[model samples]
Target: MEIITINYPLQGLEDKGPIRPKTLAIGHFDGVHKGHQSVIRRAVDVARAEGLEAAVMTFHPHPKEVLGRGSEYTTCLTPLEDKLERFRSLRVDIVYVVTFNLTFAAVSPAAFVDEMLRPLQVKRAVVGFDFSFGAKGAGRAETLRELAGSDMKVDIIEPLMMDGDKVSSTLVREALAGGRPETAEQLLGVPFSLRGTVVKGEGRGRTIGYPTANIQLAGAYVTPRLGVYAVMAELSDGERYSGVLNVGVKPTFHDSLPMPVMEVHLFDYEGDLYGSTVRISFISFLRSEKKFASVQELIEQIGADALKARSVLSAFK
Candidate 1:
């Protein structure tokens, strides 16, 4: 899929007049969970039936982060690279990441359709049932149809629901924050994962005979509850390994520092994983973070965690 970063300096839609007459799916697509999958699937269907290319239009920096429009939410479900990869996996022909700036946000609904959608030559547009666009969100599905007139087709895909409630990114974030891994997995249609490059640590885990891969998170990434978790780690080479991760400070050492950290000890494996990117998929919460009486007690508990992690990941393997 073609990934295009759109900005004011570019020619906007006119730069790609040749790519018009495309089937477009529009949304912020924060998590690109099951609900978003539904919208993209419909867009692909429309593109196939209408004999046009499929594209996804999304806002970057989130409208909220750019314009300070609404209540601030936690980080994102997927980072830029991961989000684009998801769209490519869905077989989207193009991904248009529009920079959300004040000038762009000020564009009215009609002007947006004329300047952006029309210029893209959108033959058909797909959006969530509650989707809204343009300045102040003045444009709804009904308004979009009116603006398009008879020149384009608009498909308002219905909201995807589970247990009688709409599946949304906000709910997924809440679930993860609350340590409800099962619920987040249901919405994501996959395990909740964190990807980052392994970095050097204090070598404390090494001294304890359980050397771990320390990971660094991006600024806009959201972490789960501070505790121990049974997780599956995917190495850069695509190999999967089960492990126990500690997501908190070294309380066992009597350290008062409150730096949140992630340290994963891979089971039955040994190698130089430092400097390599690893993706950890959370399976289940094991226990809450606690201060142990001594290094001996902490070691004993870690042994138990390894045993439990092995049991849980056995089925996954």
Candidate 2:
């Protein structure tokens, strides 16, 4: 799929001379969660039915993050790279990644439609029912439909519900924060994961006989709850490994730090992974992070955790 980055005004930015007439799916799909996928799927299906290209329009540096919202909106579930991969998997023909800054945030609804959507030759748009845009979000789904009028068609998808609650990015984040990756997987149609680079740590895991690779997250990703979890790690070379991951400070030997560190012990593997990149997918919440009375006690618990993690992760592989 082709990716086009658009600055404010969104004119004369395409590599090709003219943008194709397409059915566009518009949203800042952070995690490409189930609800977001539904919107994209509708656009693809509509485009196929009407014989138009399937395109997606997403924003970078989430509006809330750029607008100085609360800290909760600071970190993202899926970074730009992960998000684009999901779009590609959905079979989107093109992706317009509009840069979201203070200037773009000031655009009005009518001006946005006339300057961006119409110029791009959008034949139809698929949006969520609660989607809003323009300065301070003055435009809603109905507003977009009203502005489109006869020139373009609009379809507003309702919220997707699983079990009882509505499936959304916020809902997925909430589940992760609460140490429920299983719940997030249900809402996302797969496991939630983060990409990162493996860095050198204090060679402590090796001394304990359970060597681990310290991981530094690639982007501003929301760290899961402070605990140990069963995980599946994929190296940059595309090799996968089942593992036990810890997201916490080593309280037994050191003082509590400001941020929790991430490290993983890949089962039955022993080769240098330092400086290599890996994507870790959380599979199960094993237990909360705690300080053991002694190093032996901690090691014993870890052995038990590894046994439990192996049992749980076997099903995933």
Best by TM-score: 2
Assess every candidate by TM-score: 0.94, 0.98
Relative to the unseen true structure, what is the C-alpha lDDT of residue 309 in candidate 1, on a scale of 0 to 100? 84
* lDDT by residue (tens digit), candidate 2, 89-136: 999999999999999999999988988899889999999999999999
RMSD of each: 1.9, 1.0
On the 0 to 100 scale, the lDDT of residue 47 in model 1 is 87
Q: Over all chains combined, what TM-score does candidate 2 have?
A: 0.98
| C-alpha lDDT values of all predictions | 0.86, 0.93
Cα lDDT for residue 71, model 1?
50
For candidate 1, give the lDDT: 0.86
Model 1, runs deviating above 4 Å = 9-17, 69-74
> Taking the tens digit of each residue's C-alpha lDDT, what string does model 1 give over 1-317?
88788864348554555665799999999878999999998998888887889999998878877766555444778877778878988999999999988988888898888888877778888889888888898999888988888888888888888999899988898888888777889998888887899999888988988999899874466678889999999998999999999998878875776678899999888889989999899998888889999999999999999898899889988
